[model samples]
Target: MSKINLKKILTYGLVVFFIVGAVGNLIGPEKILEDYARWGYPNGFHLVTGSFELLAAILIFKSSTRFIGSLLASCIMFSAILTLSYHAEYSHAFIPLIVFMLLLVSIYLHKQKKLL
Candidate 1:
């Protein structure tokens, strides 16, 4: 496939992933709430995170805002990694770390003008 196609695939994949995650956060499942409580966050904080996630995912679809979206997503993932690690949830932390790397790649490609 062409480089443009690959970039589109990656961008869309990230968008889907973030959207799913945001929806889950907004839905606030039992386990998710438990995790937040364990992490010392208020119950309502999930909604806040979910809102940001949704906004970032939407921004990522537009060329002009893609960098900011990636940056926000990266920040969110980094925060998740740190919080999970603080709770000794190593396995859980790994997932966010992976997402963080993907966000970094998104940021790089966006800056390199390869993602438009």
Candidate 2:
């Protein structure tokens, strides 16, 4: 068996991330609300976060909006990291932080000056 190409793997990873996360938000923003509650955020924050996640998912699928979407997502994930870190929930939040970093790298690679 051959190793998967890094770029292909990253691309698929991003697609899965956005699609699954968007569906989760669209179907049950309540889960996000629960997470916010765990982090002690106000009730209304879940709606805002869910909305952004949905929009970001759409943007990420489009070539024109990928950069903006990735940038906004970077902000959102970093905020989550900081909030969870403050509450000492690093164990649970670490995966999201790593995913965000991969998203950032994917965005950089996709937008390479010479390529796009």
Find the candidate with the highest TM-score and give its number: 1
Model 2 stretches with alpha carbons more than 4 Å out: 1-9, 25-32, 113-116
How far is 24's C-alpha from truth in model 1 (Å)? 0.5
TM-score of each: 0.91, 0.76
Q: Which residue pairs of candidate 1 clash?
A: none
- RMSD after CA superposition, every candidate: 2.3, 3.0
lDDT assessment of candidate 2 = 0.74
Worst 10 residues of 1 by lDDT: 1-10
TM-score between model 2 and native: 0.76
Tens digits of per-residue lDDT for model 2, 20-106 = 765665566666768778888776766577677777767766667777877877777888788888989889788779988988897
| Cα lDDT for residue 43, candidate 2 | 66
Clash pairs (backbone) in predicted model 2: none
